[model samples]
Target: MAHQERVVALLRQPNSMIAEGFAFMEAQFVALHEDIYVAQPKGFEDPVHPNHVYKLRKAFYGLKQAPRVWYEQLTQYLLHHGYDRGSVDKRLLVKTTRNHVTIAQIYADDIVFGSTLQKYTDDLVEVMNKEFEMSIVGQMTYFLGLQVKQSSEGYFISQKKYAKNLVKKFELESSKTPRTLISTSTKLSKDDAGPPIDSTVYRSLIGSLLYLTASRPDIMFSFGMCARHQSAPKKSHLIAAKRILKYVRGTIKYGIWYSKESELSVTGYCDADWAGNIDDRKSTSGGCFFVGKELSIMAEQETKLNFSEHS
Candidate 1:
């Protein structure tokens, strides 16, 4: 899913790429019983072979081999049409020409496609519909839990509903709003002496935050700090983690914005906070790569060895 930013970068790079249209597709599949002896869907079974299992004509969703079989079929179809699969991400397919280009990304059952030419996009949609039961969802606004809003200026993606639900899920909807992602003056320790909280809820909250990080990099650092104490979270850690939700409450609409006026250049910046964690005295470092401030990549870590003094 992090590849989304890079995909946007490709769309915004002028002279090479232009978003003609965005479409979503779902592959049709017929389900067969996992076990040969097990009964299958009412009429899908073979007429001649009553006791024998029916052969699958297409990939069945929820089956272990369904994704692989579907990809195989789709891959062959795209390759037959002159599309080349990505070297890094096998699910990414690209077809380029002197005048135009088309890129398609496949995630499980859903596919998102865009091209430099509107005719190409339309033709691709028509062709895919002819071959398979393609859904032909026009102009992708929602995919994989991320809500995307496209405009003449650029694209905006966020999990606003998910963020609000998260706040309410933890019963913090009415809590005081937090301005900061984390309180700078406060220090969180192991807090082994403090009262313990439910590990299940704490872990679930962390998991939700991790998914929210897909479009909300602002909470990544604070989430990481709170995640480390998941093994045995204390009241202090819970309070700190809840602070992030309160912060989300205040800025529910915050999200990653990709402007169409992006430059075709990659810029990277990194920062280090020496001995930031009082519990272990570990320095925290984080970095982000920007394609003209679009935030293509983000990463952070807690380093046990202090390197600030050496530098």
Candidate 2:
């Protein structure tokens, strides 16, 4: 999915790309499950014996090899059409002829194809339609829950709708807004001996919040801190997590904006807060890479190696 972000960033320049979508289901497979056969569904039974295993000629959703088979099929198709698979990201396929360049990104069934020329896009859609089961999704807008708004100023990616739904899901729509995601003075340590909360509920909340971090990077650290205590989350930890939601409630519309005006430049920022995880005496290391002032990757990891936690 990080490849998905790269594709979107490539489109930041106005008129740099024209996109369309194509997606399909399972592909035909020559290999059988476990190199033998699998039990058929109740209705598609074997005549010899109902208990005997069966074989399949096509890949289906549930099979482990389905994704691999489907990818190989897609790769062969692209190669047959003069496109070269990206050495960096296998999911990316590219075709270039003189000045015209076309790129396609494959994610399971979904495909995002774009080109410098309309003829290339039209040709791709035409051939793909002839070979696969898919239809044009037209110009890219909303994809994978990331609401996209693209124009002369570049793109704005947000999960406002998802965040709103999350607030409602957690019953925090009516909660007070928090000035900060994690209160400055608040501290969450594993050995606090605070009253324990429902582990199942705490985990559920953590999972929901983690998904929201895709667009809400601001709450990433605070929300992730609460996740460490999933095994024994306490009332204090839950309150910290709720504070993040409270902040989200106020800035529900906040999103990452890629400005076209910014010059093309790359920068990286990294830092570590020593002994941030009090319970384990571990520090948190944070790093991010930027493309023309737009953040492309943000990573946070907890490191027990104190030597690597220098300011």
Candidate 3:
């Protein structure tokens, strides 16, 4: 997800355009390399061949090899169209014609592509349509829970709809919103005597917030703190987790803005708290990387290294 965000941030420029689309019958288009047999369906079975299983020539949706064959097929098509697979990230494909470079990133069957010139994007779409059944969703507005608003200045990315759904999913619409995500004075520990909450529910909250972190950097620290207690969440831990939801409810529309005029220089900030975890006395280390004004990556890790061990 961070890689995708970085690509968008770098590709987006003044007067540039980006588009997204998915392949129709994504997996069915590919031919299976290895022979696969399946029991014939009740209505489609031939009377004489009723005792025999059908050998698959094409990939099926539930087949384990479906994704691989589909990916290979798409790769061949893109390579034939003059796109080069990214050396570092295999999912990224790039095509350069003189000074104009067009980039496309693939996630399963969905493809998001852009270029400095609109013509390059259009030409690619045309070729893709010719090769495969393409559903060209012109101008990317939303993809994979992230809402993108592209303008001449830059792109505004957010998950406004997803946030609203999250609030409603947990029936927290009536709950009061909080100004701060989590209280600074709050100290959560595994040994807390607070009543134990359902571990599954606690994990669901953590998992949802983790996905929300893809577009919300402000929640990263607080979210990480609450996630640590997922193994055996207590009432206090759940309360701390709900506090984040309350905060998100208040600032649901908040998002990062990438400016086209901002410099391409990369900047990073990293820090660690010594022996911060009350349970294991381990330190928490975190870093955030920015491309120009937009945050491209943010991560937090609870390290095993302890000050007492070194001492």
Candidate 4:
């Protein structure tokens, strides 16, 4: 059948019948298991004696294919029940009715979804719960490390707690706040003359900062510039990172707010710093996109800019 026809058929059925069908389908796969295996040298010896490699009979957490298998199973189930995958975002599924629209987002085993019609959303949760061993987390608060707050005004998503944790992890909670993430007059380069520091520590700081940039785009450009010198980070680079931490400590509660009154139109803003890099004389460009007033995307690029003295 055509995709639209299939969806119409599913919607025409009584909700109770559809719910029961989903229940039966879920039971069939509840006990299905996949095997796991590990390889070892044939002559490998244990601490007490020689031993052979073992093959696991059931799927384990660390197996590479476990997530893929689970997702395939879930996607098949949803498709069978009339949900159509979104063209723009593969992780999204859409089900539409004459008066209502429903959206379901899949992130591995976790699901975040909503519907314009309360009944449709309620029916969906009922069918899904009947089929799979699932946990409904109520309204989405925190998912995938982003803190979500839904209010009468709209929705607010932030990483304030995560930012605070990052500052504490790096022992920068007590550091003095900086006026800015990066100094406007300062330029960073691969400092060959600077002494080496612990690469592991530098890398860890960079990793934490990178994650923080998800909600804190203000420091994105500075963090990216400092990250480039991770292989040979110097005192200067470390200071720059510490400055970011100081900024975080001072503004830990700052976060993005999405208002209900905001328009859905997408708009973007771009700015560039010409010859921002001292040694390389590279210009840095930064851009942020908004759907209404809520930020939807942010990016930064570093470009080599030629400079010459004029007469």
Candidate 5:
């Protein structure tokens, strides 16, 4: 998703279009290179060959090899038509003609693409239609769970619906909103003696919040602290997690804005705490990388250290 966002932020300066392969995964349009056979389904067996298995000439939903076959098919088609696969990301395909360059990003069967000229985008759709079934999404408003709002100024990306659903899932819709996600003075630790809570519920909440951090970097550290006790979460840990939900409730519409005014230069910021974890006394380090003003990448992890026996 980070890669997708970065690509959009970088390449969306020009005309852009989004397309999806109709019935992409379950479609029988994918041809198999290797011969395979499967048992006939009920009511589909032939009368003469009742015991014989059916030979597969095309990829199907239940087949484990279907996804790979479809990807290979698309790759071969793009390569044959002058599109060069990206050295870093194989799914990214680029075609250069004269001074105009068209960029296409493949996410399974969906394609998000753009070019400096309108004709390039039109030609791309024309050729794709001749080869495969496609549904042109016109302008990209939503993709990969991120809500996109594009304008002359720039793009606004968020997950408002996902956040609302998350609040409802945990039954925290009517809960009072908290000013802070977590108290600055509060330090979460394994409460071995405290009353136990459902580990599954605690883990699920933590996981969802972690995903939300993709677009909301402010909650990263606070949620990371609550995530440590997922294996044996207690009442205190659950409370901390719920606080994050309340905070999310109040800030559901918040999102990052990628402006056309900002330069494409990459910038990164990193910070760390000294022995922040109370249980293990390990420092947590984190970094955020941005393309212009838009955050494109973020990561956080605990540091491991070895102590000397003499000390």
Candidate 6:
């Protein structure tokens, strides 16, 4: 019911052309039902039946065709207005004019839109409001649990608040912070002789860190290494998990910063050791990509540029 109301509101907003479209549809339905029975199927035998209700003249809320009908209607309107749907992501609508371009992303009832020029953005909003009943929330801050921090330099996305909540949820407030993600000397093994811990807790910690990796690529290798032992995690695996949490505690404020000066150029460096893992005797590969010269230097300094250890 709520969904239907929302769709109807979008069609009935002031200055909306959808009203005219709806009227046209209603007229078509009436013309189609002129000779056909307008009452319930069972009541069609009795013309004077008072309890008989009129059959639906147009797509109704519970009808299976409702979504398709609405989609066709909206798509036709956008196509007429010069908006093109993205090939890969259909929810993305783009409109490019002589001086500016506007993009809108649709996620069910929510929308995220941006533009290269303010006039274009405003024009889109006005047109949408004229056709749909929508409330613009203005500048976006948090969407789908990602905390967006936009700056003149570039956008910085993180989940600091979500990380804090996770820390509290796991009761890791008393844990000591670790200096490094993992110790070079410590080697984790699937030890049959070692003591076992709660596999559920170990898996939960890994899951949390996996999500943190969205903005904290520094821990990707370490997390991937620890994830291999989730099937029968031992004390050593738990220790590694705690180490990652401690690292998070120490660097909660850390995040990736996309600079405005950054170009579209993509460069990558890969290095691996002969046999970094003692258990499987398999090599550990590490690599990082850069968009600009600044990122290349940063990656070099942080990764140590040691091909021997990485290769």
Highest TM-score: which candidate?
3
lDDT of 1 by residue, 1-311 (tens): 32443465456644322322322234637333353233556878667876675555544556567676677777788999988888778988887766466788888767888776677777677777766676555777877788888776777899998998899899998899978989777777889899999999999999999999999999998898899899999999999999998998999999999887887577899998888788788989999988775888899988897445553
Give the C-alpha miss distance for residue 128 in model 2, angstroms: 2.2
Report lDDT (Cα) of residue 197, candidate 6: 92
The CA lDDT at 169 in model 3 is 89
Query: How big is the positional error of residue 105 in model 1, measured in Å on the Cα after superposition?
Result: 1.3
RMSD of 3: 2.6
Least lDDT summed over 10 consecutive residues: which range in candidate 6?
Answer: 15-24
Estimate, for each residue in 98-143, the C-alpha lDDT of model 3 and write its tens digit: 7667888888778899887788888988887776777887899999
**Candidates 1 and 5, the one with greater TM-score:** 5
TM-score of each: 0.83, 0.84, 0.92, 0.77, 0.88, 0.64
Tally clashing residue pairs in candidate 6. 5
Per the 3 Å backbone cut-off, how many clashing residue pairs does candidate 2 have?
Answer: 0
- Single out the weakest 10-residue window by summed lDDT for candidate 1: 15-24
How large is the C-alpha RMSD of every model relative to the true structure?
4.5, 3.9, 2.6, 7.8, 3.0, 11.6
TM-score of 4: 0.77
Instruction: Encode model 5's per-residue lDDT on 212-267: one tens digit a residue.
Output: 98678888888989988988999999999999989989999988887766766778
Ranking by TM-score: 3, 5, 2, 1, 4, 6
Q: What overall lDDT goes with each candidate model?
A: 0.77, 0.77, 0.83, 0.70, 0.80, 0.63
Q: What pairs collide in candidate 3?
A: none
Global CA lDDT computed for model 2: 0.77
Model 4: per-residue lDDT, tens digit, 1-311? 23323223332333211111112222323322555557655557465645555566534444566556656766777788888887656776777778556667777656777665568878788878766765555667787778987665666678988988888888887788987888888787888898878989999999998988877877888898889898889988998888988998898877777555665466889999888777777888889887657676788888997668999
lDDT of 5 at 52: 95
Q: Which ten residues in a row are the worst by lDDT in model 2?
A: 25-34
Return the clash pairs for model 5, or none.
none
By TM-score, the better pick of 5 and 6 is 5
Q: Residues 1-311, candidate 6: write the lDDT tens digits.
A: 22222222222222221100111232122112222234466635655666666656555443445445545555556677898877756766677666455666665345677665667777877776666555666667777667877655456677888788877878888888888999988777787788999999999889988888877888877887788889999998988878888888878887776555544455778777656666667776667766542233222112222345554
Ranking by lDDT: 3, 5, 1, 2, 4, 6
Our model 1 lands, by Cα RMSD against the true structure, at: 4.5
